[model samples]
Target: MSDTVVIRRSGQAGPTSEVVDISIPSDQVFERLVRDGAVAVARWLGFSEERLADMQLAVSEAVNNAIEHGNKNDAHSRVGVRFIVRNDRLAVQVVDQGTGLAASQLTEGRPSIQNKLDNGEESPRGLGIYLIEQLVDDVELQSDEQGHSFIMWFNLTTQGKEGVDEHHD
Candidate 1:
């Protein structure tokens, strides 16, 4: 179960993937749909209740960010979320049709929300990213002319290797 899940998305380079793509209007109401559905799938795939919560929180943050920040709360714009689950890992991505996150934040390692507040960064930017970073095993960010994507990975094995961090409180 240490193997990585290969997900091949359009314009995304990776191995062949079994992707679950859900696109919704840029309204915040749609966030719950994606978060709940992903948690249900993760549970059906044998993840424990604890794991379900982790996925739920991370997905919630990503979806909220997509709708609020990335899509600028535009109901007409769309937010795309793709879930990929394999034997070894589960990867969730939230893509928005808006300007991406800053590249500098992507390079910083394990940035905490407190750091942002101390540094006087804008509200919730550091907080949301910090929460997602702490919840998942790994997070990947991509920025392009189209929009930004927040791709998060959850490991599914028990070899002490990273699958998911169930607790970040």
Candidate 2:
């Protein structure tokens, strides 16, 4: 199987930016890549403490899904992670080498009763996606004959306005 990976400026008028493209086999390296990428982006964007933690968690979860489900933890298969830092936004894409589910299949609710009765086979699966959606401003899933890609993005401008609030109780 062959994969095409590309990372460049959005090419649509913007401020200074950077892109990091990585291709790693599904293993511990995949997880480390995700963590390091999150840390680098957080530092570059000047993310506050809470925002940094949220971004780390969301990116880690997305990478976990890509490694565990998409690539089946196969050390041979590859996962692609792209970090795009635009003018006021940061977008991260995690692509895997497995068949993907359709966007229609992702709903904002708990598993259905029928799905639950299957001994929770699909119960713990969707939490990562759900948490990603909650943490990031936008989450998108795209798939074609090639493979599946999950994209998560956050607006740095809005985050700056909100500041960091660790204690909400």
Which candidate number would show the highest lDDT if scored against the true structure?
2
Top TM-score model: 2
Superpose all Cα atoms of candidate 1 onto the true structure and report the RMSD in Å to 1 decimal.
Answer: 8.2
Segments of candidate 2 deviating more than 4 angstroms = 1-16, 102-105, 110-123, 160-164, 167-169
Error of 1 at 41 (Å): 1.5
> Lowest-lDDT window of 10 residues in candidate 2?
1-10
TM-score of 2: 0.76
- What C-alpha lDDT values do all the predictions have? 0.72, 0.74
lDDT string, candidate 2, 1-119, tens digits = 32322333334333445777766777865577668767877887788877888888888888888778877888777888887877778888988888756475355665355666767
Model 1 lDDT, residue 139, Cα: 92
